[model samples]
Target: MPDLSIQLLPGLKLKNPVIAASGTAGYGDEPNRLCDIADLGAFVCKGTTLKPRAGNPQPRIMETPYGLLNAIGLQNPGVEAVIEKYAPLWAGWTTPIFVNIAAESVDEYAKLAHRLDKVPGIAALEVNISCPNVAAGCLEFGSTPESAAAVTRAVKNATSLPVIVKLTPNTSDIVALAQAVESAGADAVSLINTLRGMAIDIKKRKPVLGNITGGLSGSAVKPVALAMVYRVAGAVKVPVIGCGGITTGEDAIEFLMAGATAVEVGTAALVNPRAPIEIVKSIENYMLEWKLTEMSQLIGAARR
Candidate 1:
């Protein structure tokens, strides 16, 4: 195993640095047939809301050159349904399962967090503040420092479980937002949520995605994600979970060097459900090749 475990949050320890990102991994059960979910450091469930969302219309996804565009609209069965359906299954698993929640208002986020506070299967609550592909205030709460802090404070007050604020890349100053969340009592922070982008069909004179615009994610955004992670990691005292277009062990290493305590695989996992397992193996191999003892030693190694 090479002892790849790392401390992701103050009281949370992960077996490896590779975690499955929210929205990409469906409740840790969908990919079980394709890969071993227990091998992952953790699995972040799909974005849950206070109520069920049908999501955007059809053609919600479009493939770019080296990335993907999506407007899933946080389509989920709400918190109660999530607990009833997957909490029991997660309780039996060895790997930790973090529930990712999204909301239009701070009150909605607080209510959802309070509901999940006592759920035995959940290990943490990832507050998603950067969902740009939807209307009705998805990105409104995350784009500004004030709203971000307020949401963080509300969630922290409602739950004893660790709260990780998921940040968006569309902000003018991500470091400021990260610092604000930390000040507001976030246990940790994760970034960079998908970059806001849209694809247009010139030939058809229509947008490629059903929702005119969508968030872009994949290998193409790795460099931008790394820069944001580097800046945010230095700004916030809490741990940062890097996520964007990480697809390989090398990509994961880049994130670790940029100061991420752990890395989350999103778009890559869609291509290969076993990508996280491979990432874990690759990280171990890299550590062995470099004679490194712990993954923590690699964090912020690129800073120097």
Candidate 2:
């Protein structure tokens, strides 16, 4: 078999280059029932916060042609509850669990990092800076290089674990944003978070989602995501984890060729629980047909 293992960071090595995106696997309990968590390179838990969030109102998810729109609003139990409940369970699994955290303030981000630092079973942190910073009048921390760097610095100061800043495609300059986070101590970076989108209910004469607007994801966003990953990869020295609309091994390979060190399977897993594993298999098959010996040959093959 082709070697599928990869080192995402100095200390964070994954058996494969496929991660189960945050929220899709819901802390790994339910998904484990549908697919083996051990098969994934890593699992990012639901987007977490300092406090438990009820999330946005119902009718929050809508399916579009080859895409998914969600305004779930970071619904998650408080960090303490997650540590107490899921940490124990994660400690026993062979797969590393990365806690994906979001916060409204810089302090909250640091605190979340501090709380999870040195905790057993938790291998790393994936900071979700796409959230609104209430202190900045609802401006998303990821909207600017300054705010994004602030969050990255805060989290780095508070934790010893590797920090993977999950970048938002909503930014004006994604390459700059990636560079900012990388300088602020991000060990790796992942992108692009869902694009802003909405739908109108033609029959009801109203919006489809209660939140009115939500993040757009799935195969529809693949092209846009591929472009951003390619740009950011060239801009930063840190590993880039490509996400958005990746539904198959072919999709994963596109990101890899575009310079992604790994790929995150999000909406596809919601469509098929076995998507991640299936993608891994397909990548392996491709490597075999091409006679590739290691992941390095594929990590940025197209860049050449």
Best by lDDT: 1
Model 2 misplaced regions, further than 4 Å: 31-33, 131-139
Cα lDDT tens digits, model 2, 45-150, are: 9988888988888788999986999988888999999999999999999999999998888999999999999999999999997642123211378889998899
CA RMSD of all predictions = 1.0, 1.7
Which pairs, if any, clash in model 2? Answer: 218-245
TM-score of 1: 0.98
* lDDT over C-alpha atoms for residue 290 of model 2: 97
Look at candidate 1 and tell me the lDDT of residue 126.
Answer: 95
- Model 1: lDDT equals 0.91
TM for every model, in the order presented, reads: 0.98, 0.97
RMSD of 2: 1.7
lDDT of 1 by residue, 149-193 (tens): 999999999999999999999989999999999999998999988
